[model samples]
Target: MPAKPRILFCHCNYARVVPDEVKSSVLEGLCKSGQAFDAVADLCEMAARRDPALKRLAAGESPVKIAACYPRAVKWLFGGCQAPLNAEHTEVVNMRELNAEDATNTVLNKTLTPNLPADGSVAKVEGEKKI
Candidate 1:
């Protein structure tokens, strides 16, 4: 069986783009679920400084679910730091588009449906992997 995907939460503190209610509720749900997660104050700031953490986060071949604004933006941010995500193993939950509960559920779910855009422009929400 595939290992449970790790959760990565972004506070979006730099631009305040993610909705306040959604961010709080998601964080609450993550805490309540008791799942291990990495919560960063802001991904944009990390990308700007090329923080080593980004490289670490993108290191493992295991799947990762990132609770952030947009898939494309998340892809861009990581790529900028020379820590490009594994598009096939990365699932980006757009807190900007999804409600708090939905976002939380998506992140906490064991099933990983990779959401990174294939073309690098559009955001792909639906599961792209086919059996």
Candidate 2:
């Protein structure tokens, strides 16, 4: 079986949009699932400075799900990485608006499920109501 995709969470250290407690709660839930993930202080800054972690992420062939701010910002942040980031292989969840539980559920559903479409976009699961 193929490995599950990586889940990256940005705490938005600089912007301070999502509450720390909320971010921590979501991170705890995700960690408990035994999935591969990284909860970083600031992915935007890391990507801006060409952090090695970004390079590593770019090199991998696995799909990536990012729990962060706006999708546009996430895309712009990682745009200049050495290894090109393919839009089809990436998904970004807007953490700014969601509560801890909803954010956690979103990440879990997006990363753990095997039913994603060819474009790597998440399809709504049957009977699953959006928070």
What does candidate 1's lDDT look like per residue over 30-103, in tens digits? 99998899999999888777688998988898999999988988998887666789999999999999998898
Q: What's the lDDT for candidate 1?
A: 0.86
Summarize candidate 2's per-residue lDDT along 1-131 as a digit string, tens digits: 65566788887889768777668877888879887777788887886666768767655678777788777666656654443456666777777878878877888875543222233332233364432
Question: Residue pairs in steric clash, candidate 1?
Answer: none
List the candidates' TM-scores in order.
0.88, 0.71
Model 2 spans with C-alpha error above 4 angstroms: 1-3, 110-131
Q: What overall lDDT, based on C-alpha atoms, would model 2 receive against the true structure?
A: 0.69
Pairs in steric clash, model 2: none
Best by TM-score: 1
- How many pairs of residues in model 1 come into backbone collision? 0
